[model samples]
Target: MKLTSYWLDTVPRFTGTPQAALPGQADAVIVGGGFSGLSAALRLRQLGASVVVLERDRVIGEASGRNGGHVNNGLAGSFTDACAKLGEDTATRLYKVLNSAVDTVETITRENGIDCDFTRCGKLKVGNRQAHEAALQTDYARLTVAADPEACLLDETQVREELGSDLFSSGLLYPKSARMHMGRFGIGLANAVLHAGGLIFENTPMTGMKRTGNSFEMTTPQGKILAKSVLMATGISRNAPAWFRQRIMPVGSFIVATEPMDEAAMRRIMPGGRNVVTMQNIHNYFRATADHRLIFGGRASFSRSRTTTDITSGNMLLAAMRRTLPELPDVKIDYCWGGDVDMTVDRLPHAGQWNGVFYTMGYSGHGTQMSVYMGQRMAEAMAGMPDTNPLAGRAWQKIPCYGLASHFLPLVGAFYRAKDFVQEMKE
Candidate 1:
């Protein structure tokens, strides 16, 4: 499919130094150039390690550039669900790690002088139904207890006032959360990595990787990179190593960008221009861009291809938006696009070593913040300091379904969609 207008025309351009050819060898080699790989490279370079990054496309070409730009806190699942799956102590540690992750991204952007339009406007996880309200309340309590003192719950009226939409029954405002220009952010990080003396090779896809003795050899179309260690940060690309592909399923999610609107129009939808996501199983996340466009995103599909001119997904998202704000029915959609999200069976991100090669992906929709944190953690882990690592000895052990996610994702998606439909009907 041809790239959509949103992706083709709307994303910010990078004026950084041009990418260089793949290096012959490095101290550390990264397979992907999205948030995880670039962040990892930056941190590794800061630690005085020589690094090389291989990107299949130009930087910010896929999910990292195409998401809804919500720098959300915590994992994708509810805090209660996380605690249930990982236990209270483990889940609490994970939550703290992720909360700090959000701040880490902001700090990196600021310290490096990256102009990514990052704003700490907070995030609202809104409830769409009575049942959802109960879940939201429980989540609010759990998150408040797990969160810092600044986090608080917003009642229905407060949610309405904050979001300027009555569609939500309640909201849990994560004060530490923020929004960003994802595409620009990706470019900024790439530039930062380059400025720090790390090498990035654009349009260089990894064809194969093999573990040899104590090091890994990564083969690309143009050349091969041999390094002491390799990090796989390919979020949803099917071209990943076989062992890596088995653990994560790449589900496609679409997003639509409305024509630029005035501040009054934007405020009518998202008061304070804070990012908002509904509390549904198949949730919808939206945020106003720095350009005042309503970037509404949701609606998952199993299709592997997307058309630039096709507005079907965009129309569907607009209809969903109008269901909450009847005043915006005629809002013109300027761009529509889709990207793959790496989802795991347990709905938690996977970050660990596989086959002597370190890797991190499958954040679901929580990549914006968690990706940065995982990258930093992965760097620290590679530096021979596992005991003090944040992700060490956690409940993030490999799940049984990790090996089946890629093969059974369609069935899994259908089941989840059915669950979402039933829940939406109950609303």
Candidate 2:
């Protein structure tokens, strides 16, 4: 099997702006060229700002192109828990913004004529345990009443009809959720940024940043640049300030894409063509690609993503996939890969100005839509627009002993696995 992202392998490569001398100054300098950076660059240009984006690797080479391809709406964790922790009104607002985030992605795709196979396939949160059936129903009731009227609860018969697997007991359906070809979207957004007046430099990493009165001076290997405003769209950066790094934990998520399956089998497994996520502590999320390939992924491990780790995690995911869906047609794995998720303690995204630098990140694992949405909003906010940030005033606490995440993550993983085992046994 190829050890690369199926999304990136299938789409046309983005040949960014020609290698040239870096501009001396720009109105705004974006520190990362992932979805958030590209989205912000596009919007900033639209707002008549001279924008420059510096990417350490190829555009969209990281988490943006290496995700499960679900542009799902709503909170990544329990909405009920979010309400209790963030207060009902705040949680509801945060949930609604995610719905808006999905719409923003769709709008950008349509407006830019990005043929990324964007589809409102909706999302199905499957419950894997007998107890989860009632819990999911309760979540559905709470979600529909507070945040999403487009959501519905699925009973056992109805859930089974939507899924080919018998493992799921019930489901929560969010019709506003969508999926798209992430590679195509990333390339399209980059092209849109170029089509506008923005400048993007690939293979350029911002190694240093100094606040020069009224402007920030950024140093890269290519050259130095000055910007009146800076947006740290960098997610889980290896070179980020210690303060930023402490609040964000980089967790590895692995995925595997099956060879194109029979259309009949595909329909059987995913009749509704919905993004599927199971209700487990270390749950899996999956969706069928436009070409009928099953793109399955999960937090196979909490370790950082690398070549060896990716292979090990990919094997774990394939095994889990087989167990989760016995009805899946026999097919070889076409692609396997992993990426680091910018996880926060609260499992929510935070965006606002820090000191003098504007930043957005900490999406945890549910960043696909929020990253893009926050990028645009941050750009607009930088352009002196009204604050549309939902996560603006939330205190971002540093992860305790953040430096030792690697040593402890495996233990945490073990504990979660035991918890899941006990839960399954009870069922």
Candidate 3:
């Protein structure tokens, strides 16, 4: 199996602006060329601002292209807990923001004519335990009245109709969830930035940046540039400014894709044709590609993604997939890869201006749609428009003892695994 992202391999590699020179000055300079940066660049240009994007690697080579391909709506964690912690009104508003995020992604793809197979296939959050089934019921009832009226709870019989596996007892369905060809969308977004008079410099890393009067001077190996405004769209970046780095934790998320199976077989495995996420502490999320490849992903380990770590995590995921879906005994695994998630302590996205720099990140794992939506909002705010940022004014604290956090991930992983085991045993 190739240790590379299947999404990135299937689409054309992004070749940035033809012969575009690094300008000495721009109205806005975006750090990181992932979904957030690219979306911001596109909107910035539309607002008549000269924008420049600096990417440490190839465009979309990071978490943007290395995901489970679910443009799902709703909160990343327990909606009931979010309501308690953030207040019901705040939680409802944020949940609607996510619904709007999906709309934003669809709108962008349609307006740009990006043929990325965008589809509103919805999502199913399945539970394996009876306790989990009860929790799903409670959450579904709360959401239908408080935030999402479109959500529905699936009984065990309904769950069996949707999922082929006998593991799931019930599920909660969110009809607004969608999926897309991430690679195609990323490359298309980059091309849109170029066509919109924005400049994208691939393989360019912003090594340093400091304020110069009202403008910010950013340094790179190739050259330096001055920008009146800057956006730190960098997610879990080791090279980011210290203040931003301390607040975000980079957690490893890994995935494996099976070779294209027969369409009939794929349909049998996922008759409902929806994105599936398990209700576990160390959860797994999966979906089938347009070509019938099963892309299954999860927190295989707490360690960061590396050459060796990816292979080990891929193997773990393969084993888990087999246990979950017994029909895949002879299927070949075509791709295995991993990426780091910008996880926050609260598991919510934070976006606003820091000091003088505009910033947005900490999506945890539910970012595919929010990243694009927030990017556009950040762009509008940068252009002197009213701040429609839903996450504005939310306090962002540094992770406790974050300096030594990576050393403790294994312990955290072990604890969660044990907790899952005990919970299962109780049933």
TM-scores of the candidates are 0.90, 0.98, 0.98
Where does candidate 2 stray beyond 4 Å? 301-307
The better-scoring model by TM-score among 1 and 3 is 3
lDDT string, candidate 1, 46-111, tens digits:
989999888888777777888888888766778888888778888888888888889999999998
The numbered model that scores best in TM-score is 3
* Model 2 agreement with the true structure over 71-91: per-residue lDDT tens digits: 999988878888889898988
lDDT of 1: 0.77
lDDT of 3 by residue, 218-284 (tens): 9999799999999999999999999999999988899999999999888888889999999888899
Per-model clash counts, in order, read 0, 0, 0
Ranking by lDDT: 3, 2, 1
| Inter-residue clash pairs, candidate 1 | none
Better structure of 1 and 2 per lDDT: 2
What lDDT does candidate 1 reach at residue 369? 87
Q: What TM-score does candidate 2 get on C-alpha atoms?
A: 0.98
